[model samples]
Target: MADRPEVEISYDLERIDFERTSELIRASYWGEKRTDAINRRAFDHSACAAAFIDGQQVGFARAMTDYACFAYLCDVIVWPDKRGAGIGKKLVQAMLDHPDLAGIPAFSLRTSDAHSFYEAFGFEVSRDGMYMRFVR
Candidate 1:
């Protein structure tokens, strides 16, 4: 396999490719019914992270947070061709390390199939076993 290109993580909403992002999200199992308007509203309200390689977006994730108590991570997706190249990890890390989210008491996310992936980042299944959380 060829070496993966370096991934750049950015928090600037202006840098996000909304059209491509909406397409990818609408294709995802979790976001299949999501409309572009809804995505725009969500992104507008959340702290978003986008991953780029060679100036093209490869992955995206977002967090809803109050910057004091908690954060909820959502809409994590990597371009199919870019999977397994650590772009997703970088996106998640960027959200966690984002200045606004740092020191938050808890971070939570729901993933039907990516539990092991999130587990590596210290996320554990909650008592209800329906969501994963990382508590500070």
Candidate 2:
């Protein structure tokens, strides 16, 4: 098999490809009903991590954070053709490592089918309900 191209993860909103990011999110089970305007608003208010391969946007993830006490990770998606290539992991890591989010007390996310994926990053299934949490 050929080697995969390097994936570049960026937290700069200016680096995001809005159209492609919206398309990937809208295709996800969680964001299927989200409108372009809503997605744009969300990205505008959140800290985003966008992944690129050869300068083409391929994955995205964002965190709604107060940058103080808590953060909620959401809208994580990778282009269909790019899934399983570790781009998603890189995006999430970028979000977690982002200077704005460093040392936050808690982080949470909701994922119906990707529990194990998130778990690998230290997120645990919350006994409280559908959310998974990573507490520091």
Candidate 3:
């Protein structure tokens, strides 16, 4: 059979079925700071969301937001096998166009190498920017 048509774009958070989503995320994420527990927690909170394709969850993104004013893009990943498919753009555009998350005063994320990628979605960094972290 010819290749099946790709799944349409959709957005969800912990609300989507978990086992499948988690399984896809496990394969998609292959970075130094990766952990199942961390991934679980990342989407478990209400502040995050994901995109599923053919029920396989080919892309994922999450944000830290108060839901009223601020949103910080935290995790954005697309399965290695699914790159060049335009899923990443659709995924992020869904979040930015979301009614629940519109009008965010600021959206923030830091990447060692994705400056141009995030820039496609209107993200920019200033020379005065600084980030601080503390032990919990």
Candidate 4:
């Protein structure tokens, strides 16, 4: 795949096109349908990475991190048409490499599917029954 064209992954939130990103997430199965105000606020507080091909946004992944030891990766999505092109993998890599997140001891995400995709990056399922949670 050396000859495959390059896709630019960027961490500049100001360069992110919010409308496109919102639409991308809203269309996903595990997506949040948030208002523009809420979405903007989330973007403002999170370390966001987006993948662009020739200037069109095709992928996104963001992590809420303390810029120190932990990051919770969320809202990872790649446009369906672009899925097989390695954009999702590249976007996740960009998030992991973001300066605030690199070297963090722990990263966590919840996915009902795509386990193997993330496992390839060394994420392992918690040992059976090792995790407990509460939600309202």
Candidate 5:
């Protein structure tokens, strides 16, 4: 692991800028080209964390949680230029440490490429049968 930069992790919705977050997401293959309204609604329903350097938003992660039993982390992203700078890890730690998710029995997320990253935080691939259906 590399030394983390002096980045501030914020859970404040006011500190989240939709355009900036969407830009970071849009750059990734797992991200959809979503409109601001759509993104705003998603954030509205989720617990979100963002990383900033000199007050500039550089990374973000969010989770939809009942704050009791389940949390599904989604849309985790770090700006392309800032990848590998430890911002993503810190952003995730902030989300998991959020008061809303404390004592939750289950937390899960989907990732195609960052398995090891999440594993470092104690996430594991499910061994039991799991299922999903997309309403397309």
Candidate 6:
């Protein structure tokens, strides 16, 4: 396990500013055009957590949940410069600890990399689970 950074974990800055968050995500990822959609989901879900370094959003992880037994962690990314420094883990931990997200029977995510990183939080592969995205 990587050592945690000295940054503070928070759920307040989550999706607060779409323009800013969108820019951060776009810069971190390989130029995906989904800010409007991301904003819509973030606002619609109304339950997310973010990690900030000195009040600046360096990492973000969000979850959509029924406050019961299901939750999906989505759009988890940390700034490129912040990668490999434990910020992502901190952000994820913060989201899982959010008052609206805690105690869910299951929390899930899909990632192309960072399997070991996510596994640090006890996330494991489901032998029979598969995700199908309907883009209509």
Best by TM-score: 1
Q: Predictions ranked by TM-score, top down? A: 1, 2, 4, 5, 6, 3
Q: Write the per-residue lDDT of candidate 2 for residues 9-92, one digit (tens) a residue.
A: 888899999998898788888989999999999999998998999998898899999989999999988888988888888988
Q: Evaluate candidate 4 by giving its C-alpha RMSD to the native, one decimal.
A: 4.6
lDDT of 6 by residue, 1-136 (tens): 7665577776664335566666776665433766667666664665666667776767777776788877777778777788878787777778777887677768776666656667778787555443311110
Per model, how many backbone clashes are there?
0, 0, 0, 0, 0, 0
lDDT of 1 by residue, 1-136 (tens): 8988999999999999999999999999899999999999999999999999999999999998887899999999999999998999999889999988988979999988898999999999977766999987
lDDT of 2 at 40: 96
Q: Which candidate is the best by lDDT?
A: 1
Question: How many residue pairs of model 3 clash at the backbone?
Answer: 0
The 0-to-1 C-alpha lDDT of every candidate, in the order given, reads 0.93, 0.90, 0.63, 0.79, 0.79, 0.67
Compose the digit string of candidate 3's lDDT tens values, residues 16-96.
Answer: 656655566566533345566776776776455556676766776677778776776756676678877777777777767
Error of 3 at 7 (Å): 4.4
| Runs of candidate 4 exceeding 4 Å displacement | 1-3, 127-136
Off by over 4 Å in 6: 1-5, 13-17, 27-31, 128-136
Q: How good is model 3 by TM-score?
A: 0.71
Off by over 4 Å in 1: none
List clashing residue pairs in candidate 4. Answer: none
Task: Tell me the tens digit of each residue's lDDT in model 5 across 4-82.
Answer: 6699988898888888897667667767667767788889989999889889999889988887778888888888889
RMSD of 1: 1.1
TM-score of each: 0.95, 0.94, 0.71, 0.86, 0.85, 0.76
Regarding lDDT, does 1 or 5 come out ahead? Answer: 1
